[model samples]
Target: MPRQRTGGFHPRPTVLVAVGTDKHRFDRLIGWLDDWYAGSAARPTMVIQYGHSRPPTIPGAVPFLGHGDLQRAMATATLVVCHGGPATILEARRHGHLPIVVPRDPAHAEHVDNHQQLFARRLGAARMVALCESQAALTAALDAGLAQPRSFTVTADADVQAARLAAVARVGHIVEDLVAAAKPRRASARH
Candidate 1:
């Protein structure tokens, strides 16, 4: 016999924090979120995966989450706060959550380059994600997003869809090139 769903439905707002799997720490974003959570009047259920970043000294914060666990958390989350990586942002969108993005800064040593900042700005301009470059911006976004969560539904316009496809193709090509370069070369038989 199959198990049946038994629990009565009770809606509770949830927030998911994903800081990516980079080697460098994103303490700036973690600390800011901690402060925001502490100051908020109506606190939602918060699930955080700090990755290589230091875990916040807050009640619900955790150092890391496995892939399946992160997916499960995101599925239930009303809001997603994440580092501005293309894959992470897309994953949040795929889960029907428009993420509030804080890009890693090279100057802050959060990344080796400022590509995330540039990507976040472009995505923000396209209305795909909320860009939070500073604590004030993050706080404002959090207040608004938590009050009313937005759907990340892509429009059916052909031009927009084409543009998105092209951008994704470019990123795919870049990833392919990087992977190819990282592969070990075979030794010459004539040597």
Candidate 2:
């Protein structure tokens, strides 16, 4: 089937992979993507932000990208594959792509905890992300995305965006309250 364009989404054969700026190595995800690329005859244009992981075999791989550059790349890409960082997933969604998220596994020493997996599962349950925990799943998601690009493109939902921003602000307020509660009280000076 020919690729479809929906919601101003152009069918481009580009893929952007972001492993985040965490200190832990996400070599597993990089390796999986590289292996998949090697076997793909279609050869989608791929750019990877490898962060602290060992260098990828894929060309066009960069250690990091500036915020403006990353957003620009996301705007043009047909697909986004990213580690389970919520910010990256949100960025992809903001750019109209439903990201394929591979949560870093703590068992593989890819993270200090399994928070990524937990957060990703919550987003996956809401259909906000295409969660792929295994190489086979990732391959299938990528194949589907390449074949029918529009399926992954999402129109901006103003209500949903507002809700997300509100939630983040609420969390920030809670954190501030907690910090205030923990701080020692300054005694009044009676001169």
- Give the Cα lDDT of each candidate: 0.75, 0.80
TM-score of each: 0.78, 0.82
Error of 2 at 20 (Å): 0.6
| Pairs of colliding residues, candidate 2 | none
Which numbered prediction scores highest in TM-score against the true structure?
Answer: 2
Compute the lDDT for candidate 2: 0.80
Off by over 4 Å in 2: 1-12, 165-191
Model 1 residue 19 distance off true place after TM-score fit, in angstroms:
0.4
Tens-digit per-residue lDDT, 1-191, candidate 2:
11222635454488899998888899999889889999987688888999999999988899999998898888888889998876777678777788899999989999756767877887888888899999999999999988888788876655776478356435534643553455444222332
Model 1 earns a TM-score of: 0.78
Displacement of residue 1 (Cα, Å) in model 1 is 26
lDDT of 1 by residue, 53-77 (tens): 8888766778788878887887777
Per-residue error at 72 for model 2, in Å? 0.4
